[model samples]
Target: MITTNRPTGPVRAVEILLAGARMQVLLVRSHPLIPVVTVVQPVVFFLVVTARHPATADRADLLFAVLLTSLWGGTLWTAGGILRRDMADGTLGRNLVSASDPRLVVIGKCLGSCLLVLALLACTGGTIAVVTGIHVPLAALPWLVAGLVFVALSGTALGYLLSALFVLVRHPVQLTSALVFPVYILGGLLIPTSALPAPLAALARGISLYWAQRLLSSAVSGDGATLPALLVLGALTIAYFLVGNVFFVRVVHRARVKGTIDLG
Candidate 1:
């Protein structure tokens, strides 16, 4: 009976992440409808929203913000769903006791899910651009890409956190569905964060989504504080990842003691 809490080294970590990516590939191959569910639905939602309120320079920031929301929302669903599915399918118990850190299980899910989310975001943005002719200059593409990557990292960390949390619930998939819009609504995914009530706004700042939206929105608007925004985004990403790992560690410990890894 080995009871240990040692850090997972870089090599092992990468292996775990790659394993998660491979798992995702198998999932996509098995379920051809994943792309439709993750990508097309968001694009449709974007189209509907834009129709209701078109983008102009005054509110053009919403364009990328909404795209970020699509990826963010997708990450939440995919990560939580994957984790819950693994639990139900009996894989989580094996991984929890295997060589990998239990946290890596969540991290792996996030990495694979983020890849899909990126593709989904790109599809949504490209489709919107084709019809609306809203284009970012070539020079801006790098900045835009960086902003999107930052958002993805933050979102991935968020998904990892949710993966840890949703494991404790009966209907974990609904957990993500419940949070998808509400977090955005409060995080200023469509509107500015300042419009939120003071307490809500403060709470928003603590979450990675708020920082991600702020950074991406700044990049979209060409306000040119992207370096600082990137810094903040990185900080928030690290914070979320660390906090999520802590939560996962606690849950894993509890599950091991109670022998409920498969039960959840």
Candidate 2:
């Protein structure tokens, strides 16, 4: 008989992550409405808003591009909300009993959400390019991708923090929608941070969304590229993951204490 030792270390983490990701895929496939609300709404908004000012082609193009980029926040929020709902309903608890880390499960779902966002962005961006007749700077595409990934991670962390609260509170979806809009607008999707009032502008500059948008904007805009934008985004990405990890651990501890995490 042949015997093999159990996996350990980073290799085990990767195995757990992949397994958790497959589970996430199954969950997403079962929930069709999530894609409609989470993915389609952003695309619809980009098309409608940009169409209003068709004559200002360049302005509309830039606005549409930024809008597409901002969809990461909504995607992450929706994914985290769904995960929290599952956790509260005890499905996640059942998964926790398996040989998988809860943190890895979270990571897997976040990655799956990010992949969905990327697919949506590609589809929407392609459609916009065709419908609006604007040519994207092909050379800047790599940087744009990098910025999107960074923003998605930060936004996912923020969503985790919010989901932790929603698990406990179970507030109305409309209220959550109302709460999320400012984060988008103030994130420089609608108005540039430099154009906002001084205090709000300063506050916006400190946010992960702000830095993410700035990095993306500088990459594709006619304005000169700025190294500082990349630096800011990198810093914000690190900060968000750290904060999110702390918040998630605390929430998990609380859930355990309250007996909220149990297999039904």
Candidate 3:
């Protein structure tokens, strides 16, 4: 039987988180499809977009859009089913019975995924730059850096929420795939929200990615106030975490009472 005597302290928590992050990074490295999804696919998309819209090839905003799309894809494939991976590997039960909060492990895994995606983003950026000779103004660098930071944070939060929610669904892979294009459209990652119908555009505003795209656009253009978009993105991220926490608590309780971590 698993014991609930695991050490409880800030140090212990940090250790667990670091361990989880390491494990996640290893898993991502081992997974063949993950690299393709996070890097190659985005590069291919960038190529196609530049080919079709040669006029926009030099625009930094185009690069930002591709990066945001890639980040969303990474969030779906890497962090979306994190708990399911733990359950399949027979660690979820142990984590549940441990005294330390399992959510910390999840958070660490998400952070690890974000780090991996960031590395992949750099590769994607390099490839795109080489292929298209697109150049970003030095003046926009600070804004771009800030936008990237928020993108990572928002993606991590969304991944955490999805990881918790996906555990409740019987077919998480199906759900994950189904989620891809809708968010692309709704988040305005590829197309401007202005092109979307008014009602759809209004609904898209509820998604953090919508605001994230707005921030990135401003970042690339070096125009418009980024504060409003940043504030909305931050608010939506916090909301996702709060709701996800509630779901995680309920799911963990149910798992404990039922004596099974395979809630799906």
Candidate 4:
């Protein structure tokens, strides 16, 4: 008699995620500065701005929001950076040639990024809350954790899309960073939308981070807007993931066609 082993859906997903984790570690370990820089840069800025505006009691709160947004942005940036570096160094092409699904590779790297984001959030959020006295209740824990996880997944999807684009353009850092930073600003992280110019405020309302921030605020404040904000965030995360996956698949195909996908 012969025996065979089978995997369930969740298990398969876990395997894929592990693959992504390994890829992220292997590709990015040499450049630990990315997260280190991310951890420090925002703290310094937050300190400086809060010191100058002592009247803003919410400064630390707003700064925490901004850092949260940057967690997603930084995850995307890290994924794209690793993809670009791998492509340039011929690592991605070689990996693609393996029997493993490119999607698995993508998923694994994203898992790694998600871990980083979670760690950063815990460390940074704890520090700010302690220093600034931003009280988060256990009642808000569910929504807060859910929102962060969704944000991380969305960030991972966005990273895959940007990574594909970076491969195509070969120079996307400035363009991607420019496109991403405003999302944080609009997310009510730095300043409230009411404070932004009319057009910019409108654009901010259109972003997923806007909903995410609202959800987080509601969770923290136990406000009436929590449900609606959660609904919007859920929808946005699904949409972004779908669109990003489609874009990544297309770009991978294009890369294969151009013969730019072979190992160097």
- The local distance difference test score of each candidate is 0.70, 0.63, 0.79, 0.69
Candidate 1 off by > 4 Å = 1-9, 28-33, 58-60, 170-174
Q: Which stretches of candidate 3 lie over 4 Å from their true place?
A: 1-12
Better of 2 and 3 by TM-score: 3
Best by TM-score: 3
Better of 2 and 4 by TM-score: 4
Summed backbone clashes in each candidate are 0, 0, 0, 4
Choose 1 or 2, whichever is better by lDDT: 1
Show the lowest summed lDDT stretch of 10 residues, model 4.
57-66
lDDT of 1 by residue, 1-264 (tens): 998775468977888788877777567544545666566766676666777776454334555666666666667667656667776777877777786666766677687777776766677667777677675667666887887777777777877877888876667767667887777777766666788888777776666666666666666567877787789889989987887787787668767897665744
TM-score of each model, in listed order? 0.83, 0.81, 0.89, 0.85
lDDT of each residue in 75-170, candidate 3, tens digit only = 888988888888888888877777778898898888789778877886778677677676667876786678778777787788789998888777
Ranking by TM-score: 3, 4, 1, 2
Model 3: lDDT equals 0.79
Which 10-residue window of candidate 1 scores lowest in summed lDDT? 55-64
- Report how far off residue 133 is in candidate 3 (Å): 2.6
As a whole number from 0 to 100, the lDDT of residue 94 in candidate 4 is: 65
